[model samples]
Target chain A: MTAPNASPVQSRPLWGAGKTVVLLVGAAILWSYLGTGSNLLLPFQADGRHQVALFFSQLFPPNLSASLLTRALRGSLETLAVSIMGTLLAVLIGFPLGALSAYTVMGNRRFSEAEGSSAVARLWRRLIYDGSTLLLNFLRSVPELFWALIFIVAVGLGPFPGVLALGFHTGGVLGKLYSESLEALDSRPLEALQATGASTLKVFLFGMVPLALPQLLSYTLYRWEVNIRTAAVLGVVGAGGLGQDILVAMGLLHYQDLATFLIATLAIVIAVDFLSTFLRLRLIPS
Target chain B: MAPSIEIENLVKVFDGRVAALDSLSLQVEEGEKVALIGPSGAGKTTLFRLLNCILTPTRGTLRLQGCDVTRLSEKSLRELRARIGTIYQQHNLVPQLRVAHNVLAGKLGRLSTARALWNFWDPRPDGDVVRALTQVGIAGKYWERTAALSGGQQQRVAVARALVQNPDILLADEPVSSVDPALAQEIVSLLADLAQEGGKTLVVSLHSVELALAHFPRIVGLRGGKLYFDLPPDQITAELLSGLFTRCEAERGVPERVLRGAVSPVFPLDSPYDKA
Candidate 1:
């Protein structure tokens, strides 16, 4: 067969080029119209712009009084505590769930023709796998704010509820990440372990966990960083911490106090980001 | 004495379509060293996996030390596997762990969970692991991370791990394939020597027919999911190897020269078994 005389770059339209451009432009226009219709385009109206400008003007001089500063410091510390505790709890809850949900660890035996295992045993394993996955999905699907609200109703308003909220949601997030990393690991080592007659738990602890540890630790640290931000937001539901302080200040139109709390939250987030990044790099090295 | 391994009419069909091993029958006596040789698609690895109990045959029985593997319970299988060690082409060591820990992993099957977890912190490099590492010439580097070692060194570590297992049969599937050509011969020779000295049955799969002929006393040729020949090394001939490799293609009615174009050129140039 003779080779066709074709140019490398054929004269054809790029994939989805025309349609994507049209859809994007149309979406932008629709968004703008919706914004105006819903009175969300505050700067587009004279009265609304004045109100916004006045609001910003009031927020400039932050309340750095001795009493308020002390309160804000205390709230910030609570937020930090909530984040750390929540992250720890999430790791505690997620680690096993992740291991159980991972096909490499838990579901591997089911697919293999495990000698002398009855149908009932296989059915039980299948149920555990499916149940754990469903639980993780349900936990992650509900927002942290919703969790805080539910906890507040159950346990009353406190930083404890906020911690539980963050822990539950972040647990799901960490579970998914942990399972994916575990599943994606080189299975050869695990296979070698299995061939040596190592039990499932032994294989997991010695073979799978060691290989996936660095990635799992990195993911956990990343989730901790996210939980710090979520913890601040969870406080808005009166679960305690800086978010609650911000909500109280907003309710009383204490814009300066709100500005101070916002600044503190940003500073805390930046600090945690720096710490998590340093830890991830130093430990994982890759 | 019972044979170390016996497979009768073994068949393995993957995905219910491709037959990886077809009605293969073989037996290896205790302390015997055999080499499995064939092209890429041959069932050498499959046979090794079956021997290691990593894979189950679709329609045949495999007896390891007179124990019918296919009929054994999970607990019995575990006990059976504890007596058979497998080495892989990639070495299959946990790279981030220390060599001592990797070697000690051999005992995980026998150790209790508490002891296993404790061993991680204090990888109690007992006499056996030390001796195994010493045998592999990496005793001093036991505390070092396995990833820091070179490819050949890593494979030696794998050998040490298998050694620590103290198995009756060592199944190495393309154990030297990932190493450089110079080290390949040394690794194979080391494995052969270890098996001989320890009186352990060794079955290795090799891509190079020369290596197989040089090291192993017996060579089993597999082609197209079936055993082509099982003979002593002295009986292997150039014509036999060429015929074994090209038989599947030739059976389809293609011309022999056209199908053997790439492989035939090298057969006369360097094959040590050409004269035999």
Candidate 2:
């Protein structure tokens, strides 16, 4: 049993990439386990954790109150309308313009003509793309609440401002998404199309559109989901929807009312999620 | 028909450093199946590009079917390109589209924009697409996607596309390089047939000297962006080939077998590329 001078059977050395990957995964899980949105200190979480427990307990006495449920249901409908309108507008307006912006579709001539070949032209294309990106950042950055606050000032407190805010930001985000999709396409078809005496828009409409449709649909659906979330928070700034009703209930110390709002919001979100998933899957090619 | 092509004092420089084509002048009469043979860096593709107006010349004039190619605009170039069919080594068929669509793309330039876009009403090359496919021996596989076809079949589709165009002049850039010897011979024969019918001029750049000698009546040799030989294929001696291949070695007369016929030693297999 006298083995040669080999360091005792070190249990597979714990050294290669698989071990590294497992260790990284374990570290991530451990970090997620320890962290909540707030600090690890006990004081701030105690009250919130208690509220969650109380809310769970109230499930038996689940807010079966009829009139309150009806109002929450109505608020959910408003949220749906805001999301649909915003997404439709984004898809309708952004698709064609996005195709025009792509180098794959437009070629060096159209691009160089619109911009140029020099550093100035490169800077120009970049500046235009960046301007749109900045606009998207501005729209998505303010977190819907601030937009609703600003809109509520001018439009005087309603779901109209919430819808407007959603439309504005979603349009910007979708436009950028669509333009990038156009850029990533195979250029050969567009070149073939353009070389056939087709105009830029015609090439986009015929050649690029059908090819890019799946990407466009997926991005639009994603934006719709985002808009639904944004619509819920609009009430925080008095832009309207379920948020407004929830805000009032919270102000009145209506814990049971809060429960009803949360349940309705959850139901609406789940429904939208299911519908969007089905649509995106259907729109995607096999 | 007038001469299929006429190039006079054609000069093109890319980035002003590389002389892609230097004062290159050439002409091909109707129904002439001319083969251009050259080594790497000999400016074969550059000449094709300039002839088709895909790239403008830095200096000189080009005339196709007696019209000044140098004077054409982008739109006119598209029309000119339709008249002059080009086949690349890669067969350049849009892989995503169906073979039918790619082949019928022959009508893309000839038809109105709306007709081409809608495509439903475009009967421009309706029966011609099928006929061309039949000629290329892939008539049965028209509806399939282009990628589904083999390399030989894809190249046949490229030829079918050009045939559907019903072009007056055919320009092929190493059309057989992607296929095997048997298929290469068949393709060369097909080009020869196109030229024979109604005097269509077929100009092809070939990598094989044997194929060129057997299939082409006229051969143009290029060396370092300059024309070295423009003579009858019957007169294409091994000495001339060696000169084209190497200026120093060519001064001595070549061996008899080479002068008679040289079997291209590249691949062992000979004849039809694989079946469609």
Candidate 3:
């Protein structure tokens, strides 16, 4: 007989779904540690600690010279411009793709159903939906760094390549996010619009746009914050930003200059975060 | 002239098993004001949705102004639906939009895509939007965000939205079920009076027998996807109401509360509008 105090939840076996997942993750971590031959205690070792200390000591008393500061500032500005341009382009490319991928975002009321309608119409919708999903998957699967490398080859180095790379990668990311937000929207308002005999475009504008704008903007702004950091790193591939300056300083053993550039990157990232947060509050209702 | 709506042997089965509406036949003549009353699961919403052309009948014919809705093209169906304005229980207004924009949504069918988008941003102080709002007595809250309004005020906005549509037939699916009895009576009277003024046909579903009996000339009672009775308010007997309510409540495992005279149903309204 079951225990008198046992509830259905308490009756579950010891190896429940939660415990199984925890065990699997623990096993995977152990396997990875063994496979990679990683040394967790290396930093605590005497010789390794001395090397780490020497590298860190070089990072202090960062160069505050006017020339280096000016260069760092210019690089930071370039990175900012790249991120803004990339984000703008991403919106342009992603908005339509995102809308097309989500079945609910589209205007056809009949299309919402699984049955009825001409086979040809259904086929067309299916193709568009699948095609958008596939394209978005491909675009995002390739990292921004890889895209930067490709664009550098095609357009020849500098901020333009960085812009194109971030645009391509972030467009995919934003499109997926935008489609999810659109799908997650409260459908009743949309149905109310559709019932009014409004055309698909009109329904989208009046119903979907109003409901989705704040959410879509929030996603785009958050992505912009991420793109700023990526834009800096794109400079490692000669795509142009503070990362290039940092890379040069390191290559030449100019740790002081590297330190200054690192600080500049940190300052800019914080600035963008603050600005995006402010804009989110001002534009989107709580 | 053709009747505003016609249904013959209408049947709607959800997921091929659960029938929301059965072989029901109904006809609403031009400019008629009808009330639908039944228990919670009586398929009143299904009937309204079928009338609005949003839900297709599984096996029957539905005609709007003599147009066979099932056979119509998508484009043609939309044109037909534009003439039917529907008010939902939740009000269904986009919460983030301005009250004026929600009201102007009634004109979406009439406006082109570009014009509708333009209107969303800068609604020309067309006397129509202002006039519709004024009629509903919320003209002062035109630019206010829709969510900021109270439940009763939101209901007014919903009415204003329907008015702006200038539809030939108005379908209100339990429009006042969430409001208090006093506000419910006011809204019902307003809808009936508006329909009379515009000479538009109206079909409103109500949980309150008293509201239906007082404002509507004819009442249609439904039970379990089938019509129980179709009669004028004077012909409806207390025995008939008690039988209907008692049987419905018993099926839901609630103790029977017999109807006496014109008393309305009492709801547990901890917070109005929180129900939805």
Query: Candidate 3 residues A1-286, lDDT tens each?
Result: 8888788575567577899899999999999999999998998899989999998899999999999999999999999999999999999878889988876754234312212346586678888988998898888899999999999999997999999999999999999998888777766677678788886667777887779999999999999999999989999989898989988999999998999999999999999999999999999988
lDDT by residue for model 2 (A1-286), tens: 6569866757776489998999999999888876856455544488978876776675445476789778988888987887787677656655544554555544445411211135564566666655555665565566556666778788898888887777766666676788888766554344444433344455566556656777888888888887787788886678777888888877887777877888888888888989999998776754
For candidate 3, the iRMS in Å is 6.8
Per residue, candidate 1 scores C-alpha lDDT tens digits across B1-276 of 999999999997665656677899999999999999876656676677678777787898899999988788777888888899988777378998998889989887778879988888875667888898998788998899998999788988898889888899999878887778878888899889989998999999887889999999999998877889999999989998997777464235532222211111111212211111
Residue runs of model 2 more than 4 Å from their true location after superposition:
A1-78, A103-164, A189-202, A210-218, A234-245, A260-286, B1-3, B67-70, B120-125, B242-276
lDDT for B149 in candidate 1 is: 90
Tens digits of lDDT, candidate 3, B219-276: 9998767788999999999988876665543235421111100000111212222244
Name the 10 consecutive residues with the lowest summed lDDT in model 2 chain B.
B260-269
True contacts kept of 3: 0.52
By DockQ, who's the top model here? 3
- Candidate 3: which pairs clash? none
Q: Each model's C-alpha lDDT?
A: 0.82, 0.70, 0.83
Q: Indicate whether candidate 1 or candidate 3 has the larger TM-score.
A: 3
Among all candidates shown, the one with the greatest TM-score: 3
TM-score of each: 0.87, 0.71, 0.91
